[model samples]
Target: MSFLSALRRPPAAVRLNASYRATPCRSVSTSIPAASDKPAKASATATHTISSCTEGTVLGGLNWLKGQAPVTALADEEYPPWLWKLLDPKVIPDDGPGGQGEKVRLRKENRKKIRDVQFMKTQ
Candidate 1:
């Protein structure tokens, strides 16, 4: 016998139908209990509430430095103004030969690159 058959349970006794085919044994009580009988109410037990300001009111050290200067403002100042503006989808020109097609091509290229890297790693 196979390992799975050795571990397998013997089939339960089923009632044979008039056609001589084994039929599934079902319990006589088929009616499910109605859920509407029970009264719907919230639990009485008090649950632990979490506070928004768990880090305390003190705003000194590194936190104070971060709050003083925003990261986006710093990045805007560091890079050219046009660099961030180019990221907007509306700003991108659709007049090119393959406007939407270019995006699909780029996605396929990226997928191929990922697959190639995975294949190389496996080899």
Candidate 2:
């Protein structure tokens, strides 16, 4: 009998639905003792200390340019008209003869008509 069958694992349908592997997966074993075998861990408390400012400080030689650049706000003129529609639906003018849902339905119908026309055309 197979290892899985000996263990009386769940049915193949259940196993297949889950994270199933054709071959048994190998797990890495460490040399450390199990929790039950090992002694209880002692509580560790960290002690903080502020070091003295010495002349041989490592952070001194770093290159940092001390200057500020002029910051300008991005205007609507800088953005494309389509981007405004994405940022806010209300900002976009629905100039067409129908609403948003109507436009989507028309688009889908147009795609189907194009597909039908293409299908009718030769290979």
Q: What C-alpha lDDT values do all the predictions have? A: 0.40, 0.43
Candidate 1 residue lDDT tens string, 1-123: 664342222222212234433222211222333445345523233322222222222211222253474212122244455543432356445556668767866888999999999999999
How accurate locally is residue 1 in candidate 2, as Cα lDDT from 0 to 100?
Answer: 65
Model 1 score (lDDT):
0.40
Each candidate structure's TM-score, on Cα atoms with residue i matched to residue i, is 0.22, 0.23
> Roughly what TM-score does model 2 have, to 2 decimal places?
0.23
Model 1 alpha-carbon drift over 4 Å, by segment: 1-98
Expressed as tens digits, the lDDT of each residue in 67-92 for candidate 2 is 43422224335546553243233443
